[model samples]
Target: MSEQSRGVTVTPQDDRYPGLVEGYNHRFTGRPEAVRLAATTQDVVDAVQDALDTGRRIAVRSGGHCFEDFTASPDIQVLIDLSPLAAVSYDERMAAFAVGGGTRLDHLYQELHDGWGVTVPAGTCFEVGVGGHICGGGYGHLSRRDGLVVDHLYAVEVVTVDDTGRARPVIATREPDDPHHDLWWAHTGGGGGNFGVVTRFWLRSAGPRPTAPEHALPRAPRRIRRADVVWSWDTLDEQSFTALLRAYTDWHEKNSAPDSPGRHIWSNLIVLHRSAGSFILNSVVDDDVPGAAELMAEQLAVLTGPGGAAPAHVEEQVVSWMDTWMPSYSWPSDPRGRYKNKAGYLRAGFTDHQLAAVHRHLTDPGYDNPMACLVLTGFGGQVNAVAPDATAVPQRDSILKASYSAGAWTAPEEDELHIAWVRRFYQDVYAETGGVPEPGDVNDGSYISYPDVDLADPVRNTSGTGWPVLYYKDNYPRLQRVKKRYDPRNVFRHALSVALPS
Candidate 1:
């Protein structure tokens, strides 16, 4: 295939190849023979078709924030970079906001709020790509109030290869009678890179769209309050530590009901590894609501507990909605470098045993990565309002979502140490469930966006459950069917991509 046919193809010898192949995680390097930096939907279709014709393994990248090396694997020979196709506009035909697959969260937020005074409940990281995030049921601070980003997704434009080995573009909408409705559901949460390449997403909530543009989607929050509270590691003994955790979880359990007033608040308790010095609880709440301050104060008191004093450090500030969200909300001091992440959901508070395991791992002195931490973020609320089978994302009853991450590796030799530390930590935490979070009493399932390839390994996933079953639950079978229909040739696939069902 010629470069003209594929839009813009950069060979390994090209100067742009280095930046084109680089993703958020610097640990793993992608060395595709050529990179197709797509500038339009037609460009993506051309690139995929050309790769298919040439018998080249293809990988797709948007904002390049995939936690795993799914987009950066050595097996890939052609990478279709969608970052240059960032565009957000109102689609009169669909009567919804259309966002290009490569649009970043920050750009999307600004365009939606400024142009339309509306927004989708999306990822916290400003630089995250919309394609993979929404496809994997993206959620963030506004999620508790407005629900998952996919909940607003009305339609998707995708390029796929059929049984004839022909690549074509199709638009799938949520309308019941739409012939491609199944395709739309698959993208809701089937996880990215399984069925096809998503070129654009049209977002509009289920109900009717009023005549006004602002009413098309959920209105942007008037104001937001940010609060931070920290407890020194020295101040937390095992007893206080466990109490603090229980307090945080207990509050979520009570307030996570679909209609709870506490739904206005979103927070994450960052239980930093001991090397970080202090563990902190950061929260954001809708400042326009009544009793917002009182609600935050109440939650803070519960977290501190009866015996424990106030947080050693506390700061609260009110900022414009755009200010809190537009700036980088990424947690790490150095997020652009090496990192590994695994994710899981909790239906209830962590058991005493689980809490102890977390304490043990966080306090382990032998693991010296300062940036290593286990983050438990508040979930549920409006998210649980939808039925489990309503969309492809099945974990509707989860109260909290937890992520295990380790980063900032100084050298390649240090990679094993960081990996071992995080793996051991996760395995011990879920030891009773055979290593990883198997769907059961304590663990609901895993989040697909986190995409941990380790879960597919027999050595790492002693969970007695396969990776797909853990991530998709009963939704896996349906997703497999969609995979068979949309990607019969299986052109868009990776190590953990959905298997073609027998």
Candidate 2:
């Protein structure tokens, strides 16, 4: 569309590409075909159009956190970077915040809180881009109380490809009469990079849903009383391992409900496999509720007071009365790393024998690290009550959310082990549970939030189920339709990303 973008930039091109990545924003060292720091929505559209015209393999990098190198791949020539376009604007009439796709959670948090005393429900890591985080049904500390991030999406502005092989970059808004409404629907929990480059999003997600108190989304308790549960690896036997896991499972089952939230209870941020020696479990309570610390103590007594001696490591912190949680509150000490994670949707609470299996895996001296912890996120509040056909992400309220074990090292040597451990652990756990997809898949659905290409990988997983059903469930078909209407040529294609029928 412009004479200036006729050929690639004359910048020095780094001839070789290895695992070339940087943690900070200014890390594009190699001279790419062209790296246009897009400053506006129109710039993004122009850059995409130019790439299409030249028939170049274009890569989009926002915070470059695709861990799998989705941003700058092994063979990408042109890169349309939205990193320079990070900006946040508040519009009073919409009562919404417009966020740049390249902006990270931390930036958004500061801008929103400092400027408006409001915050978006997002992952715990402050670094992940808001776009990808929301795309995968973004959830966080506020999840038990608030639904996924996309759950409150007001609209989006996307740069897409039309049927005639033309770049059609327009703001796809969520409206009853909008023709591209399907695009808006897909944007809701359809996973990022599958549709198009979302320049910005208008979010309508609000905290404190209006359900009855028992059903109201769990908010941050007035005050938060935090405590840790630590057990040394050398101190336990096989039976101890089994009992520990069983205790966790049993406690989760018996105390995982309406009462927990009313009492402002969240969960034990269990640091399982020790990277060093013994791991830790960071647990929390309603700091607002008087005697909240004592209450958590009582609960722990009921769960783990048996033959085990006092915890080998214990730490506690107590804070303010207001209740809230930040982004994906997680286990990884290093938020930025090449990593792959898989998830399972849970229905029934795991049984004792199953808990024993869990212990075996967790206590495996080999599985020493916080990454090895099975993150058990609670999922029973308003999450389960959504109407099935309402949005694409269809895991409407279940009992608990299960994230498979292992956070591997960043070094290439440890990469294989980390991924292998996660995959094998998930496989074995599912084997004990029945099969991959777990017999009673929550509402016959899974979440798109935790993306696992394994579902589509015939070698590793033989679930026969495609990525759509695993994440979108019945909503997959609609997403395909949205993909068709918005990006007919399948321009925004990525591994584990959704594609429309040819």
Candidate 3:
């Protein structure tokens, strides 16, 4: 191991090599020649320069929460770890909040809220790093009210490789006339590892620059009202289950308009397999909103209507926003467990046929994993107000996002079983679209934040539509142009990264 002002470089012979080779997901482990622990932006630049000079493959990792093997590929010769660069502060020069790309969501949220009483609409997973999250159009509980994280993104400081193979930092903003504006646009939702390494992000709401710190971003809610309702599998027959799902979907579809009263409400329905014993519906809303309690009760009533089964248990609480956000509500990462996740953007509620398929898969006796589940997350509202082409995220009109996932296994032998089950389940649900969610009236495609390699596989995604179309929709071409301009040598790429124009 060699230590320098830039950072520490751990070679294969170093003791740190073993720990740095693996990430959050235990499924993939890399055998890189060296690991560069970048402590500053200059460290990143030097690391990239070294890779370019040595003709070695390189990859970057922030919080190491990547779902796939993008950074953990075996072919990677040098891994640049940015976790050491974590920092969050307001940048008066840029009139925006400057967040280190390596900063975790939990750290970002606490700093923004405690320091300025503001926050961004990002993902619920607090461990997620801002580097990839913001670039992939991050969204969560506040999305329906404020819009996606990228919607408020002001500028990004990325280290790009020029045509001459020289690595340098470039600052790109949302300003239309800015020469590097396309670079900023591509990061909005084009996903990470496609353009270059993002060292810092400047965040401020769209519109005139705010003179005061408090006025720069959306105000953090004073308090939040949360409810978790669960229904036992025994009480849910096919009819009741289908009715419950339909009720939740219909309510969101009707109330997800930009100006709707229900915009303050955010919910997620986790439909676990029968082996899990019960399915759960978790909802939250700003307690400061008028009739917040009443709205919550009404939504519960709709889901547990006469036609559907009554909830077996319900838990409700009101807590300060800081209390709710801190300590990270996301499930702790299990180092031994492997995970697989597939996602799609829903333009509307699932049809009767789709609902039936969901029920069949959840109750299938052949599949007994309690960890297998499908999740429907509330979306739209202010998000849909943006034009599809306004940002790299083109599925702005989607009402809900569906995720099919399976995990909780420790043995590598169990990978095939769990993966096959989810693949079959997702395929069956979208059987009409050639085993995948193709951009259409009901399905707007998938979320890049929840990247799935299956979408790029011809045998799995028989939809004929390529992965680029499924994720970027009509924005793929523009992203490619941006890719060609910034990464002329394709220095940054991965399994599902943007392809150069033919």
**lDDT of every predicted structure (CA atoms):** 0.86, 0.62, 0.89
Residues 252-364, candidate 3, lDDT per residue (tens digit)? Answer: 88889998888889999999999999989889899999999998988888887774569999888898777753353576678777999999989998977789899999999
Q: Over the stretch 112-192, how does candidate 1's per-residue lDDT look in tens digits?
A: 988988988887787788989999999998899888999999999999899988888899999999999999999999888
**Most accurate candidate by lDDT:** 3
Off by over 4 Å in 1: 1-6, 307-309, 324-328, 331-336
Clashes of 1: 0
Relative to the unseen true structure, what is the C-alpha lDDT of residue 446 in candidate 2, on a scale of 0 to 100? 55
lDDT (Cα, 0-100) at 158 in candidate 1? 97
Residue-by-residue lDDT tens digits, candidate 2, 1-502: 1344322232334322222334321222333566665667787778888888888776666665553445555466666666655788775545567788888877876676655555555666776777777777777655554566777777788888787767756766566688877788787788778888888887765453323222211233344676667778678766775666556545655554544542245564454674456765656655656666776776667545783334687667776423233332432335344566677776665655455556667666675456566777655555554665677767764566777745545565666677777787776666643345643533244565465667666666566666567677778777877787777777777666677765
**Candidate 1 all-Cα RMSD:** 2.3
Q: Return the clash pairs for model 1, or none.
A: none
Backbone clashes counted, model 2: 23
Model 1: lDDT of residue 227: 84
Rank ordering of all candidates by lDDT, starting from the highest: 3, 1, 2
User: What's each prediction's TM-score?
Assistant: 0.97, 0.82, 0.97
* TM-score of candidate 1 against the unseen true structure: 0.97
- Full ranking by TM-score: 3, 1, 2
2 versus 3: better TM-score goes to: 3
